[model samples]
Target: MSGTARTIEFDQPGGPEVLQWRTRPLAAPQAGEVLIEQSAIGVNYIDIQHRSGRYPIASFPSSLGIEASGHVLAVGDGVSDFRVGDRVAYIHLPIGAYTTHRILPAARVVPVPEGVPLDWAGVTLNRALTAQYLVNDSFPVGPAHVVLVHAAAGGVGQLLAQWATHRGARVIGTVGSAEKIALARAAGCHEVLISSDPGWVAACRALTAGEGVHAVFDGIGGAMFEQSLLALRPNGVLASYGTPAGPIPPFDIFRLNQLGSLHITSPSIFTFNKTTEALRARSADVFAQALAGVLRTDTPRLYGFDQAREAHADLAARRTTGSIGLSAR
Candidate 1:
């Protein structure tokens, strides 16, 4: 059955002010799809990019957000994996999660475990999946490796720090302020330093006894891109994941040759979770750790669904920590 639900959307690309709360008639699940009643939504930096036109919108009146956790209200024909009343969570493209109800492709939805909180699922699903690939596939962090993670108190950063430390790697992290130092340290960083310190890059080397880190996981792009390269040792890997500060400008490729023959990679979750099977596997790895009491996910800053604009502003300003999640209206 179709129903009218309140949602957030933007008629044009602009700031948080451009977002408007409107009611839309949600259609019943189509083939290979399911209708969901959201319990929580993720507030991310990419949502800001979409709201501000930093990332091009395919059309006007575009709804933002891609991560949410909720219950399955209905499932389309031929859908056997799930039924009404199953708790589920999802994070993927084709946006429009800034609402209480939505219809999404069944392939994108995954069952949330019994013990995991829905709000935590909403915010950390994508970030945990991201950390999975970043730590396991991107560079395969493990024992004997010393890694440097930028913005180590942020959503994905905390997960990466904890997971890498679990794998026996020594984690050295950089945060923007002293307030986040202890947070990163609690997340399992052997050492945490303020990024603004002029000697921070040298500090990373100092932590590693002048050898530098084996890998530098950088999501704070733009100005930090070059510093990440400098923080890596000879034959080290530099993985650039996201550009919250701003996108990285073009640079000389020969600089890699001079910078200790460093290996650099740019990874996107869409590329990593390209298949349903792959997505499910990563989700299992994340929740399993959560159930085992190894990985942490209880640190989200909660906001009501109507407060998405405020959420965007806070996230963009770096005024929030851990994860940011929006509860359903």
Candidate 2:
């Protein structure tokens, strides 16, 4: 595996158009690494952030992407965990998954389980793992809990809603528009509210019998910070994980006390799955859920490597729903 890899890279952060194709020489896997011929790459909001300079890259001429699914082409020395031709998926650092071929640390890659499609794994692995931590660790939804999931029609949102519902929690989801209400409901939301409506927070509280929800899984960021707080009950937890709308602005900590001793904390998948053992365990849980039909395995909207710009544009505009992936084939 020592040839050219067709990759999507950017010389300077700007817009989707900044993403361009480049054929770079692919090197053999180093010790503790694995060469992968990626089949599908996930398109996440973070990728947009990296491309738009909201999240700065280390330098110019950077490749953008963090998650993908593919087959192992070669394994370096001392790597017995994976063999050539094994299906694998990874979501980790170094920001270079948007290519036809890549070399990644063996520790960062996980095997895609039987019955899981590589494309689905490519687009949903990161999100599903995020949902895993959010549901099982960050807030720990349970049978007696009532939870609110923002962007319920989105990828992580759908998975979160489904997982929470599977855990027997009463799930209320918020979508940007009415068109997505059905999709949210299909993902196991007991109630769906339009986030655009100013009274959505009130509606959520009303559904919870004026007590507010036990937890709020908010990814919309800044714009919805106060609203998310308002949607929580006394001593409720707010898991602020993403900033797709924009980074959350500084706010008063005392506001939590005023809001019935509410708790606000941000959690990251990287932090939750920091160790190799933790990463594999979490990935196994996600795959088990996927195989058990707890998480839907619907086909995601896919764009070719050449259409990376369009994919970013659509994602930034919030024009697509569920998961979307870049086809590396």
Candidate 3:
């Protein structure tokens, strides 16, 4: 492994301008860790939230990536199940996914299958694993269910839509622009609506025969959180996983009782991957799904490591669709 690598660091929390691409020293693996020469880094909306101080756990001068996939260069003491030359990918809290090389806990890194491409491995874990839990555990979907996914063209949205459809559930999706409608529809949304339009919720109710869906997956919190409640059937779930529109407004818990006994839940990847065994079990399911052709790894928008700021800007402005990647050059 090279003694030095390039990483994006920030001194203070702000907009995309805060990110700096510079050469930094690569860290050697400590006990029970491994140094991965990164291949593709996943750029997520949560990264933007962390950089802007909305989610303030990140300290200054921090490396800014949540997950990546690459080849293992060195293994620290007592490391097993992984070796010096294994292709692996990992995701977790303690950010540092955005670099040419990274030293991560060996137990968190899972080896990629022979048929799966390395670049795809890096991009799949964070999004795909979340999708896996959302489908399998978070208010499980099946043939009798009708589901609604907000931002249906997003990285997580696409996977959820496809998985729901493959399970014989009718899926409805909402996107911000007209261009995204077709892509969401193609991704398995039986019906797609433009969220920016005033009548989007009305469209949802219409699609469900005015009774609303069995469950509503809402990641674009704020106003959408309330709107999602109106679009849910009695006893339906409103899965609020993100707050991209802004923090949700204060409301009465009785509002849920008033709105057909709706349920609201805010979930994060770290909670699902709380234990190494839990993480491996989820990753194994994701890998199995991808290998079985339920999830597509191709079509990710790849960007270079130096273009990190531009990548964030594009994501924040919704200028790009599907997944965005940072290639370690």
Give the better candidate number (1 or 2) by lDDT: 2
lDDT for each residue of candidate 2 in 1-329, tens digit (9 for 90 to 100): 55899998999989887888899998999999999999999999889888888887998899989999999999999999999999999998879888999899999999998799899999999999999999998898899999999999999999999999999999999999899999999999999999999999989999989999999999999889889999999999999999998889889899999999999889988998899999999999999999999999988888987999888888888888999989999
Cα deviation at 307, candidate 2, in Å, is 0.8
What lDDT does the true structure give each of the candidates?
A: 0.90, 0.93, 0.86
Q: What 10-residue stretch in candidate 2 is worst by lDDT?
A: 1-10
lDDT of 1 by residue, 97-206 (tens): 99989898899899999999888998888888889899998899989999999999999899999999999999999999999999999999999989989899988888
**TM-score ranking, best first:** 2, 1, 3
lDDT of 3 by residue, 23-132 (tens): 88777788999999889999988899889988785367887878888999999989988988898999966887888888988888888888787788787678888888
Name the top lDDT candidate.
2
Weakest 10 consecutive residues of candidate 3 by summed lDDT: 56-65
How does candidate 3 fare on TM-score? 0.97
lDDT of 2: 0.93
TM-score of 1: 0.98
